[model samples]
Target: MRKTVSLFAMLTALLVLLAACGGNQTGGSAGSSGAAGGGEKKTIKFGATAGPYSDMVTKAIKPLLEKKGYKVELVEFNDYVQPNKALANGSIDANLFQHILYLKQFATDNKLDIQEVISVPTAPMGLYSNKFKTLDSIENGSLLTIANDPSNLARSLLMLQSMGLITVKKDVNAATLSEKDIVDNPKSLQFKPVEAASLPRTLDSTALAVVPGNFALAAGMDLTKALKLEEMAENYRNVIAIKTADKDSQFAKDLKEAVQSDEFEKTIDEQFKGFSKPQWMTGK
Candidate 1:
């Protein structure tokens, strides 16, 4: 009888301990959220989509920020939306993956006060296809897939217009092209807007597809002779973006310097040979 009673008491104690631990965890999370806005720490957080460029910022820029007596934290964002939203909401200090035009679109769309601080590097988008060797060989009504995201969709459409597949309004900027902007549609190509990374796999399925340079590299698509590439010089340069309030902040300058540095660009050149090829595309 005493043995049985001891076991029951031990079980009761274990249950109580578990409940207390759970409560502590919940309280910890709540405490952090409450204190987030009141912290006096000398640190800045940067958000970037998980990719090579973002890794570059973490590897190169984070150190620079720290050397200047600022604690730096790097946050990775998976989707197109939340990173900028976090920046606007004070969740992160800045973001680096976006281009100038797209940053403007992000600002306008979300009604945020972020602005482009530095043009980092152009990813140089392209039309890659196993079905059609060249644009002229592409059939009328060739099913073309593009990125479905608002920013990338516009980029793809601008490339299509640049290739003469369609015509857009004279006043429409490449950053803001929409399906409605297709002023001329001669070939009547069937447009399929898909996720950016998924387009390379569908290359065999679609007659033609617009792909960003980084994803093309990820998919092992050869651009040496297999595809036509967009020029980075005159347009389509990517940049480091930040909240307008933090535009001139110390961390922003460190990020811009780190990305634009010769050492970092060398890494980009070596890792991504073709699209990151054009030197003029970099902010340096």
Candidate 2:
């Protein structure tokens, strides 16, 4: 009888131990699955040029991302080169200051595998001058400054072409435009290629300067007073970029969603005050 009782007790304890082990195994499997399902990454670092891009992220995108349980860190850069470098080196998870053309050119030139996640508002380039109020007011042989980087230099040249100040070859692609591409210069406008960030500061010295929209805004130039404004196009619209490998990751998707949300649209409208127009909101 005692042997029978001992046997029964051993069987119950064994069953309990087996159940406990099974529970542990199930819990472990669930944890693994949860991670695979993209359990929240605690923080994401976003890089941007110091100005409107950084401002928008802090005032609008940051709060929205925080609501999704992500701690968003906004890293501000002063130049065009550093933001992409930071992104490439993983110092930042993503960047939001460049357009498709510039990003493509930068990636190709540097051999970096970067990709755009979403299109943001555009700060259309503007021709600003301290010496002249209108294009007609400028004289022949006047000095003009433009961005030196290939992408923006091309864009600036195209803007000059559009203003009837110069003309490029009909078959020439705007992205590949250069000073040599200027087949006609009616104004005899001498060109000086300067760093994009310095164009605003050059206004005090140069006869005229073609300032990027963000830099113009930073320097408090009146856009309405610009001699000419570059027409906004899809390629010119600024975008959010990430590593090509992370383009489809959950974090990238979340960022896309956040920027495309109605709340973000309203925030941009209120804060940017038409300094930039959201391409997505306008159905562009």
| Overall lDDT per candidate, in order of appearance | 0.70, 0.82
Model 2 lDDT at residue 126: 88
Residue-by-residue lDDT tens digits, candidate 1, 53-165: 57656765666556655566788888778988998888987777766666787689879998876665445788888877777888888888889877778877877777788
| Model 2 Cα lDDT, one tens digit per residue, 95-177 | 98988888998999999989999888767898888899888999889999999988789888888888889998888876678
RMSD per candidate (Å) reads 11.8, 4.9
Best by lDDT: 2
Deviation of model 2 at 8, angstroms = 13
Model 1, residue 242: displacement in angstroms? 2.5
Error of 2 at 283 (Å): 2.1
